[model samples]
Target: MTAVPTISSPAHLSSPDGKTAMTHTPLRIGLIGAGGISHSHLRHLLTLGADVYVYSEAGAAELVALYGGTVVDSLDELLAAVDFVDVATPTFTHHALVKRALEAGKHVISEKPLARTDAEVDELAGLADELGLMLFPAHVVRFFPEYVLLKEAVASGRLGDLAVLRFSRSGAFPTRTPWFADRALSGGIIMDQMIHDIDIARWVAGPVERVSAVSSHAGDATTPVEAAHVLLTHSSGAISHIAGIWGPSHLPFTTEYSVTGTEGSLAHSSVAERNYISHLASTDAPSGLLPEVDPAENPYFAELREFTDAFGGGAAPRVSAAEGAEAVRLANAALLSLETGQPVDIESPSAQATGK
Candidate 1:
C-alpha cells in the first residue's frame, strides 16, 4: 500500500494586466478504473498542475499510495469531489460509469469506443449533447508525433491520393484480468484491438465505405469472437486491410500501420512504439542517431491535458465523442461482416448515423 499524496495550491502568477493573480488552483479530477492504463493516467496526472482523486474497485489503494492522492470509497463521493472524471475501465463497463459521471454534472473523458454497441454510443452522445458537457474519448494516438507526421505526409500530398492501407496489431490475451477472455466483455479482437486501426483508417483516409472480415478461435474458446482479419474500403477510394491476432509471441502487442500512395509511402511498426521509442532516432541523415533525452513524450498525457484544459475552459475536444462512436460503428460493422461472412457497407443506415 503506497501513500497517496495531498493536493497543494501553487504560487500565484500574474497576467500581463496587473489584476490580482489567479491562484494556481489545480483542476480537481476523479479517476475511474485502476488497471494497467489507469496507472499511466495516475502517474501523468501527478505531473500536471492539477489536484487529483481516484475511485476503483481494487487498485485505488495502490494508486492513492503512489500519487499521494485521496481515494474515495464510492463513485458518488468521487463524482461530487471532482470537476471532471476519466473512465479507464474495461470496454463493457465504460458506458455506465461515464453516464453516471455525466448525470452528476461532471465533465467526462472515457477510454475509446464510447460503448460496446452503436446504440450505446448514440445514447451517450445524445445525453452529452443534452447536458452541454464535454465528453471526450481517449483516442490518444491522434496526439502521437508519428500519427501527426503520417497524417501530414498524406495530407501534404507527399503520399498522393492514398491508394491502400494495411494495419495490424497483435498480442497474446492480456493477463491483466481474466475478463479479457469473455467476448461479451471484451468485444473480441475486432472491437478491442483492430478498432485502433479502424479509427486510424477512417481518420487518415476518410469514411469507411465497406467492411469484410474472417476470424478463428483457439480450442475451448467456445466464442465466435476471436482473432480476425478484416478488409475495409473508404469512400475516398482507399482500400485498407487489417490483421489482428491474439496469442503468445516474442514481439507481441505490436501495431503496424502503412499507407501506400501514388507518390510514396511510410510505415510505422507500432503506433505505441513510434510514439514512445521512434522519436529518439533521426531519419534526417543516414545512420540516424538517438538523443540523450527522448525529447518526445507519451501522447496520452497531452491528450488528457487537452481534455482537462477544455473542460476547465476551452473549445471542442480533439477526439470528440462522436468520432469515438464512429470508430465503434466501424468495429460493429466488422463484427457484422464476420458473422455473415460477407462485406458490409459502411454507408448503411445503421452506420450512417455516426456522421462519418
Candidate 2:
C-alpha cells in the first residue's frame, strides 16, 4: 500500500477564526465531458469554488448554459486553460484524454475503469510519474459513507478475520448512449458496474488469488439486460461472491452486501427497512445503527474534495492509479473466467518472475 502524505495546512488558506479561508484563488478545472455524471461533478466543483471550463464533443452549449462555465471548442484549448482536467468521457476515450492531459502538465481526475487494458493504465501511470502530475481515478465507492464505515470496521478488527464477503449491485440498463452496450467500449457489465465491488473486495479482503464467473450476456450480443455472478478467492483465504445486474430501463438502482468474519458479521441492503445491521461476538464492539451520513453530502463531492486536498498538499490520492489498474485487471480476469468457464488464476509478481 502507498503511504498517504500528511495534508499540510497551507498558510495562505488559513483564517483567524480557525475556519478554512475561502479567499484563495479557486483552482481552474476543465471538465472533459458533459453527460449524466458530469452534472454531479459540475455541481460539486461549483460547491468547491472551482473555476470551471467545459469541453465536450456534444452538448457543450447546453452544459455551459446550465452550469455557467466557459465552453472550449477543442481539447487542447481546455487543457491549456486549466490546472486540472476531469475526464468524464466514455470508457474508450479515457486513455487518450488522460495521456494528452498528463503530457500537457495538467493533473487528472478520471472516472473509473481507468482504461480498457492493464497496459494502457500502466502507460498512463508511467507518463503521470514522468511528468510529475497526479493521475487520480474516481473510484467513488471508496468515498461512500457505508463502505468507509465497513472498511473501518474491518481494519479495527472488530469483525475479526474476514472469511466471506457477498456483494450485489444492480441497476437499470444504461440506454442513453449506444456505446455502453458495446463490449469493446464499455467492457460489458463486469467492467462497467461490477468493478466497484471488485475494488471494494480487494480493498477489504486483500489480493485476489483466483476468479470464477458466469454471465448471462457473455455470448449474447442482442441481450439488453446484462447480469453476472462471480466468485473471488482472496489470497488471505477470504471468499467473495459478487452479483451484478443491469435490469430493464424502469428498474431502480440497488446495492447490498454482507461481510462475515470469525467474530461477527456486518450487512447492508438498500431495499431493506433497516439498511445496515451488525452482529459481533465481543460485547465491546458497537452494534445496531452505524453513524448516519449527512443526507446533503454527496460521495462525488467528497471524492473531489479529497482530490483537491491531495493536489494542494502534494499527497497521494485516496485511490491511486495503481489501485485503479488492479481493479481493471480483476474485472478483466472475471470476464476471462466468464468466457472460459474455468477458474482463472491471478499471477502475482513473484510467480511471474519465476515463470510459475
Candidate 3:
C-alpha cells in the first residue's frame, strides 16, 4: 500500500484588504487519456495554472504536442509524477484507472458515471475513504449557471416542494469513437448521455425509489436513432420524467428542463428565444432569466476549479465518490427497467450491504 501523504494547506498571502492572495504553488496534475473530451480538460487545467502531465495509450505524443504537456509512456509514470490525476478516458476505463490512482494515494477527478456498476462505485468510494483521499466525479452539469440557479430556487423554499421534474437532452449520435455505440462498453444512450439529467434529478428531487423506462433501442442494436423515456419516482414522493434522444448524425445538441413545484415552476429550453424562464406563484407572469457570465466561459473550468480548491483545502469535494456511484446505480436501474419493461427498485448502499 502506498503511504498516504498528509495534505497541508496551500500557502497564501494576505492582502491589505484582508483577502487572501493567490501565492500558493500551482498543483501538479496528471491527465490520463487524451481524446475528444481531454481537450476540454486540458484547456481548463491550463487556465488554472496547473503543471499538467499527460499520458494516453494511443496518442500520447500527439496530445502532448498539441496541448503542451510532458509525455509519459505509461499510467504508472504519470501517476508517479503528479499530485492529482484528471481522468478523461472512455467510460469503460474509468473503474480500473480510478482504482489504481486511489490505491496509489493520489487525489482523482474522473469524468461522470464514475463506474459502470453500483458495486464498483461502492468499492472505489470505500477505498478512497479508507485512504483519506478525495475522489471527485466530473458532473459538469451541476456547475452550469442555469442549473445552479434552478437548484438554488428549489432548495430555498421559493418553489415550495417539488412535484414533477422533466428533462430532455438531445444531440447527434457521437460516432467519434467505436466504443460509444457498444452498449456493453458505454452503456448506450441512457448511461452515457442521460446520466447528466439523472444526476440532476437526484440532486433536486432527492433519492430515487424506483425507475421505469421505455427505450427505442429495444431489439435492434444498430439503430442510429436512440431514445429513452425514463420515469423516476423519488423517495420524497416527487416524480421525474427524463427524455434522452440521440437523433440522427446531423442533429444539433439541445437540452430543456422544467421543474414543477407546489408553489411555482422553473423551466429552460434551448429552442426558445429566451433559454431560461421561471414562474413563482407569488408572481403573476413568467420571468425570463439569464445568468451573467462571460461568453467564453466554460463550465468545465469551474468544475476543475472546485476540485482543485477542495483538494488544496483538504475538504470534501462537492460531488463525492458515493454520489457519483449512486448516479451510475440510477442509470443502471433505468437501463434495467428499459430492458425488462418493469419498474426497477433502487436500493441504497446500506440496504444492499444489509441484504435488505
Candidate 4:
C-alpha cells in the first residue's frame, strides 16, 4: 500500500493576486473498517469531495480498488495522515477506535450506538471536549427525507405536542458476519437494530423518563429469529412504542413509523417506497442489516458532508456526540427492562452532568 502525504501547515495560502483568499482542500479522511455499512459511506465520501485513505486489515485493498481511494497498510499510519477519522467498524471496537482517533487530535465520525455503555460514551465526549475536537455519531436516519419532514412537522408546532410515537423495524438476521447474533458484540437486536427509532423518539417527542420491554425468540441455533417491543414514557408525557425483529432470512428489510400528536399524525412505510427506493444490486443484499436506499440521494452522504463541513468550522451537525450517548443510554435501559420484565427510569443527561 502507498502512503498518502498529509497537508498540515499554515492554515491559509495566498492566491495569485497576493490577496488572502480562502481555498478549500479536499480532506484526507481515514475510513476504518471495510465491512457492510462502510461501502455506503465510502461511495458518498468520494462523491462529496474527499481524499479517502482506508485502513482495513481484511478488505482494505479490495474496497479501495472498487471505491477509488488510497489504501493504507496500518491504523497508526492512516491516523497520522488523515485530517478526520470515520469509524465504520464493528460495535465492539467503536469505543477504543474513536478514543484513539480523538486522542490523535483528529475529528471523528462514528456509526450509531456510539459505545456499548453510557459511561464509555460520556468518556469519549469528555475526551473530545478537552482536546478541542469534533466527535459526531453517524445517526443517518435524521437526514432521511421522510424522517426530516416528520421532524419538521413536529418542530413547526403543527403536531401540537406529540402524544404517541410507534415505530417498527424488521429485517433478516445478518448471518454473513455471525456477529449480529452475539449480544456481547452487537448489543442484541434492540441496540443494534432499534436504536434508530429510539433516537427518533427522543429527537421528535422529548427525553424519556421510563422504559418497559418484552421479547420473544424462536428458530435454529444459528440465525434464530427474535422480536422485542419497548415502551418508553417521555418527559413531556408522551408514550413511544418501539418494536424490532431479526427474522428468518426470507424477510425483506422493512421499517414503518406512526407518530400521533394532539392535532394530527404522520406515518410512513418502506413497503410504499418499493418503487422509489433502490435496493442493493449485490448478492449480499438479503443478508445485510440495513435496507439499501438510493445511493444518489443517500442520507449517509448528507450526514458525512455535514460532519466534514463542521470539521472545516461550520455549525454543528444535527446529531451530536452527547445525543449519541443518550441513544445508547436508552438502548441500555431498554435491554435492562427486557431482562427484568419491569420498567426502568432514566435520568436526563443534563441532570447527570450536573450531578443531580
C-alpha TM-score for every candidate: 0.82, 0.85, 0.85, 0.90
Candidate 4 TM-score to native = 0.90
Global lDDT for candidate 2? 0.80
- Please identify which of the two predictions, 2 or 3, would achieve the higher lDDT against the true structure: 2
> What's the distance in Å from true for residue 338, model 2?
1.7
What local lDDT does model 4 show for residue 291?
75
Clashes of 4: 0
Which residues of candidate 1, in runs, are more than 4 Å off?
Answer: 1-24, 219-226, 249-251, 270-295, 348-356
Error of 2 at 174 (Å): 0.5
Give one digit per residue, the lDDT tens place, for model 1 in 245-338.
Answer: 7653222345668899999999887444345333234333221110111225657667776777686565566677878988888899898987
Encode model 4's per-residue lDDT on 1-356: one tens digit a residue. 12222322225778899989765577789999999888988887887678899998899889988988999999999998998999999898999999999989999999988998878888998998899988999888888888898999999998898999999888877777777778878888999889998988888887788988888889887658899998989878999999998876656788889999989999999877464234433333455466767656667777877787787677778888878888888899998998888899987533432100
lDDT for model 4: 0.83
Name the regions of candidate 3 deviating beyond 4 angstroms. Answer: 1-23, 218-223, 274-296, 348-356
Model 3 residue 202 lDDT?
86
Name every residue pair that clashes in candidate 1. Answer: 2-65, 3-65, 4-64, 4-65, 4-68, 4-69, 5-67, 5-68, 5-69
Candidate 2: RMSD over Cα atoms?
8.8
- Ordering by lDDT: 4, 2, 3, 1
